[model samples]
Structures are given as C-alpha cells and as structure tokens.
Target: MSASVAASASARAEGGKPRGANYARHYWAFAAPAAAVVGAVIVFPWLFTLFMSVHDWKVTGTVSYVGLANYTHLFTDDRFQWAVLRTLYFTLFATLAPVVLGVIAAVCFAQKFPLRGLARTIFILPMMATPVAVSLVWTMMFHPQLGVLNYILTSIGLPPATWVYQANTVIPTLVMVETWQWTPLVMLIVLGGLASLPTDPYEAAVLDGANPWQTFRHITLPLLWPFILVAAVLRLIDALKAFDTIYVITGGGPGTSSETINILLYQTAFAYYDLGYGSAMVVVFFVLILLISMILLRVRTSR
Candidate 1:
C-alpha cells in the first residue's frame, strides 16, 4: 500500500497535471447536484417540448407522430409567418431603444452629481415595479379620452393620438412602454461595467485634450462594448419573450396586428387547444433565439 501511494504521489508531481484533473473531477462532483436540478427544471421541459412538437396532441384524437411536419407547416403558415415578422419588428425597436437610452442614462448617472443616488433610485423604480401593475397603469394612460397623455398632448395643441388603440400605432406604443420599464435595467448593467473600467484611458485622454465625445469614442465605448452586448442579449431575449405587457396593454391589438410569437403560442396552445402546434412554435422560437444568441456571442468575442 505504501509503495502504491508513493507511486501515485510521484505521478501527481510529474506535471502537477493529475492534481488539476482530480480537482476538476471533484469540482464536477460538487456541481452535479445543481446540474441535475437545472436539467430537471429547464432541460427536461425543453426536451419534452421538443417531443410534443413532433406529435399531433389533441383533446380527442390519439397523439399521432408528425416528425418535422409541424416545423414545415410553420414555414408555410401565414398567421405564424406574420407573427414572426411582427415579433421581429417589435423586438428590433424594443431592444435598440432601451440599450441606446440605457447607455446614455448610464453615462449620465456615472458622473457625480448632488442627488445622484436618489435620482438613480427613482429612475430604476419602473424596473422594480410589478409588471402587471405597470401594465395596468399604462393601460389607463393609453385610454384616449381620459388618459393624461392625451390631455398633455391636447394642452400642447397637438393632435390626441391613439396610443394602443390603433393597429398602426399599437406595437410602437407597446415598445415605448417596454423601453421605459427596461431602460433602467440596461443602465444598471452598463453602469456596473463603467465602474469597473480602468481610469487610465480617460485620464490619458483628458491629458491629450480629447473632448467628451472624443474621449468616449476612443476610451469608454471600446471597453464598454462587452457590457453593452450583454445588455443587448438580455433585452433581445426579454423582448422576444414579451407577453405580459402586450397581453395586458393590447391583448394582441385591434386584430392580430400586434400579435407576437409569444402571444400566438399562448393563443394556439391554450385558447385554441392546439398543444402540438404550440409546442412546435415554441421549438422554432427557441431555435431563433439560440441563433441570435450565437450571433451576439460571436460579435461580443470577435475583434
């Protein structure tokens, strides 16, 4: 036993490689429980969803195997195709608006001011508020005749616009509401990144007589790209999965005009009782999100 132990110790010290491998193995052992939990909660559900997607699950008929039929059907389905377009449209504005506004807000808040803390707290309040409550409040504000927004517009001698009432304006109006609620979250993320950034560049830029814009362009933005990308990824995901706000605000519009993939999924699954179709939609949606994520990840890591 002593000879064997000596041989093992000698092997460990040869490159100190075995020790690292052992540590990694031990670490994995410790992590296994959490991994299992995650697999059970998230992975399994998605696997089941994939399984359901390939079947014709119905209330009355026996579940029938459909292979990739549902996915093929999605490509040809007009309503689903339209929802895809609408979702992409909403996502574009919703993601970009918040990120742009958030970066501006982060830059502003990062500077020292008298009431900075209080102001930041107030600014982030919308993000912390309950989604349902926020939707309800906005719903009241969207009321054309009684809404304070219309009152303000009319007082300013502008036309009182249909906020979420008109099909043409509903998606943009919802995007506006989304931007208000989420901009602070992106601001906070960017702020954290800004705080951690090395000050050497900025100090050097100041000594070099670079203006605020020049300094930001040369120093701040390059370093901040990673954080901004992270925020964009988060916002993209949130915007794609957005249902609560739209559901409460427009319930998918003056028709299907404002309907997104998420709304369509819900309507198909629950309202229409087409579980298999809904599952297929979910699968396609997941794949789309995964593709976007990969693209973003590539952009984030690339020079």
Candidate 2:
C-alpha cells in the first residue's frame, strides 16, 4: 500500500495527475460490471412489476393500460384481503416463535456444559438442511396414523391428530415447522451477541449480590434486546414472504385455510392466469411490507 501511494505521489510531483485519474477509473471499472448486473436483474424486474401493475395483462389477452383499475379491484377482492390478513397473522406467530425459542436456546448454549459443542451442532443441523427437504420430511412426520411423532404422542397417552390436514391446526402446525427450522438461526445470532457481551457487567452484578436470574434480567436481557430485535426484523420479513416450506407442507391446503399472500399471489398469477391482477397484488404486498418495515424501524429507533 505504501509503495503504491508513494508511486502515485511521485507521479503527481512529476507534473502528472494520470496516477489519480487511473485510480478513479480502475475503481469504477471494477464496480461497473456488478452495477450492471444489479440493474439488469433486480431493478429491471421491479420496474416490470410496477409497469404490469397498471396494465390489464393476462396470459392470453391483449395487454392494455388500465391505470389504477387493477389496484382498486385487488383491494376490494375478498380473497386478497383474507390473504393479507393471513399473511400478517402468520408473520406475527412465525417471527415470535423463532425469536423466543432462539433466545432460550442461545442462553443455554452460551453456558459451559458437558458435550455442549456437540449438542449445539446437533441442534443446528436442522437449520443447515434445505428448507424444502426439511418440509418434505416434516410432511411425513405430520402424517396422522403411522408417523413417528404421532407414535410418540400415542405412547405418552396423547391422541394422534392430523396435523397439516386440519383447517384450524394448519397454520399453527406450519408455524411450528418454521420455528423448529429457524429457531437455531435466531440462536446463532443471539449467541454472537451473548459472546460479545462485556463480562464486567456480570462480574459487578455478581459482586453486588445479584442472583443468577436477576443478573441476567438486569444486565443480559437489556444488552441482548438489540440483537433480538435484529433477528426479529429478519424473521418478520422472511415469514411475510414465506413460500417454499408452506408450499411443500400444506400447499395452502384444507381449502385455503393456511394461505398467505405469497401462495395467493402464485395462485393468482399462474393458476388463474390473471397476470395483471397478480402484478397488482405484488405491488400492494410490497407496499404493505414496506409500511411494516418502516413501522418496525421507527419502533426500533424510538426504543
């Protein structure tokens, strides 16, 4: 670094700014390709979605400008409204479940124990697996009659119930699957936070005669709160846009009982071939998520 800078300095002293000019050119030269890819993929798709939102587009019909007609019809549609509600409902539980369980698991794993490393590795294995593969396995485990989960329940004098098949249990069951898969991620994040925490606070608290629970409550929880919120925000976004696991497990089954916005959008765009309406739904969902993110950010900053 010093040699390069000295060369540039000598070049400038020799009455030439070519070295600095070349530096700037090289920087942008390295950056331009990535910028171009981003524009082509991310920016272009978003622009297209926005454009289609205003047009009467469909699979087999002539695309025509429709202004806000698609958006208007989307809001008034009962199915879309229900799907939005379901998405929010799903997001709340799914986000909370992982965060809460993750915190507990992280706290436990942070402490010294026999075979602690092995246990943590085992715990995080589910998170390492692919979501689709996990969902497929859980699908069979959710089987009412012969599944291992039901067998264990029945052996414990509990009745085996159809999990993903039932309307009322469908969403919660899916949330459980999400929680099981993602809790370790939350754990990993919280564990990082925990590891970075200052020991002096805990030492002072202990010297101040604070009990274990009291020390953790007064020192640990407060410091950990920000990290928890980080995990919450990410989990909230993921849950809102969740599709793969839910699609594989329930397929929005039991008569749309567990359908969220993503599933609804897929069905609208592809199944119904209503591209314009689907695009409108995408725009609306995007706006809804944006509002939610802004609200979350406001709350986080306010705190």
Candidate 3:
C-alpha cells in the first residue's frame, strides 16, 4: 500500500511539469504579437536603413552595392563636413543659452513673490505653442524691413538689422527662437530640483554666516548639478534634432548658411533622392547622438 501511494504521488508531480510548460507557452504566444509589432515598426526600419546604407540606392530606380563608398564620401564632402560643424555650433548656443537663463529664472521663481503663478504660466506659453506655428510667427517678425522686431529697433533709435535674411545672422537668429521656446522647460526642471533640496544646508550656511550668493554657489549648485545635467541632456538632444523651426524659418536658405545636419539630411534624402548616402548620414547622426548621450550619462553617473 505504501509503495502504491508513493508511485501515485510521483505520477502527479510528473504531470504538473507539462502543465507548467503549457503555461509558459501560453504566455509566449500572447507576447509574440507585441514583439512582432515592435520588430515591424522599429527594428525592421533600422535594419533596412543599414542595408540601404551599403548600397548605391537612388530614386531613379538604380540600386547597386557600394559597400562603404557613401560613408567615405562623407569624409571628403565639404558640404557634409560644414553641415556637421554648423549643427554642433547651433546646438552649443541653443543648449547653453537656455540652461543659463533657466537656472536664473528658476532661482527667481523659487522665491516668494506676488503673481508668481501667473508669471510662470505666461513664461511657459512659448514652449506650449507648435514649433511650425511659432516659426511662422517669428518669420513674419524676422522680415528685415517690415517686421515688428525691426520696427522696435528703429523706434529705440537703433538701426534695423536683418534677422534671418543674411547668411551670417541666420543661425544665431534661429538659436534665439530655440532658446525662447525651450528655456521654460529647463526652468521647470531646475525649480523642481530646488524644491526638493534639503533645508539642512541652508541652516548650516546661516550658522556659518554665509550670504545668499555664497550659499548658492557652495551648496545649492552642487546639489542641483544632477537636475541641471538632466535638463541639459534633454535640451542637447532636442537642439541636435531641431528641424521644424529651422526648416520653416530659413529652409536652409541664405546660401546654406543656416543648414544644419538635419536640413542637409532632409535635402539629401528627399530632394536629391540619394537614399544610400542619406542612410549613411542617418547612421552617422545616430552615432553622434549616441556618443554625446553616453558621455553625458557617464558624467551623471560619476557625479
């Protein structure tokens, strides 16, 4: 009787194994569809782009394997090199200007003041506006002769300047638009950081007779560095990928002075119909962003 009972218990345990396997299979069956969607939507396009990058594919119905020719051409291409430099230049100013202004604004807003909520709401309105619409409005205001900006300048006893019409001033003008729209985002991030900072540091600073500036420089800034880095990373990425405002406002005009990598990529892929070369540019651009992100993340991690 004992032997028969042990055999029956072992048989039930063996039977449970198949039930567990079936449950796992059932889960995977449900997950497969979502995985397929991801592969179809995201993974496949990247693989396709990589495949096209190695070929001389054009919209003229010509396609041939070219290996690394397109990538090598980018190294020697003056226009491509200049577009990269222009992109970096625009990104630097766009990132720095907003971050600095945002920190100042955040500090100011953190203090108690009348109408603070109203001021903040008004300040962030630019960021809420659609980029294309904002660009259109700014374009109207950028007109050399008739724009309101120039009108204000002339009224202030200053000469009216060409905003985006000239090659030299085009990028800076675009950076101004970028800064205006995005500064509020940085401000919000920094403000949140300020709110969460421990009060112990301020109390200690007071005990040590430290002034507001000294306390902020010595304590607040160190504490806020991580938050600032987060804001900077976000701003840096957005600035690098800026297309709509630049496209809508300048359209890579004034003899390609304001043409960043994004504009150049668009023109190369769509206008010129050089899909292979454009794919190479896309890869390089992706790598550039990845490297910068890695570096910033390393800094954040180390800190």
Most lDDT-accurate candidate: 3
Global CA lDDT of candidate 2, please?
0.90
From the highest lDDT down, the ranking of the candidates is 3, 1, 2
Tens-place lDDT per residue, model 1, 71-112, is: 899999999999999999999999999999999999999999
Clashes of each: 0, 0, 0
Backbone clashes, candidate 2: 0
Could you give candidate 3's per-residue lDDT for residues 1-303 as a string of tens digits?
999988877876979764455677678888899999999999999999999999999999999999999999999999999999999999999999999999999999999999999999999999999999999999999988889999999999999988899988899999999999999999999999999999998999999999999999999999999999999999999999999999999999889999999999999999999999999999999999989878999999997
Model 1 ranges off by over 4 Å: 1-23
> Candidate 3 local accuracy as lDDT?
0.95
TM-score of each: 0.91, 0.90, 0.87
lDDT of each: 0.93, 0.90, 0.95
Worst 10 residues of 2 by lDDT: 16-25
Question: Least lDDT summed over 10 consecutive residues: which range in candidate 3?
Answer: 17-26
TM value for model 2? 0.90
Top-TM-score structure, candidate number: 1
Badly placed stretches (over 4 Å) of model 2 are 1-26
List, residue by residue over 113-137, the lDDT tens digit for candidate 2: 9999999999999889999998999
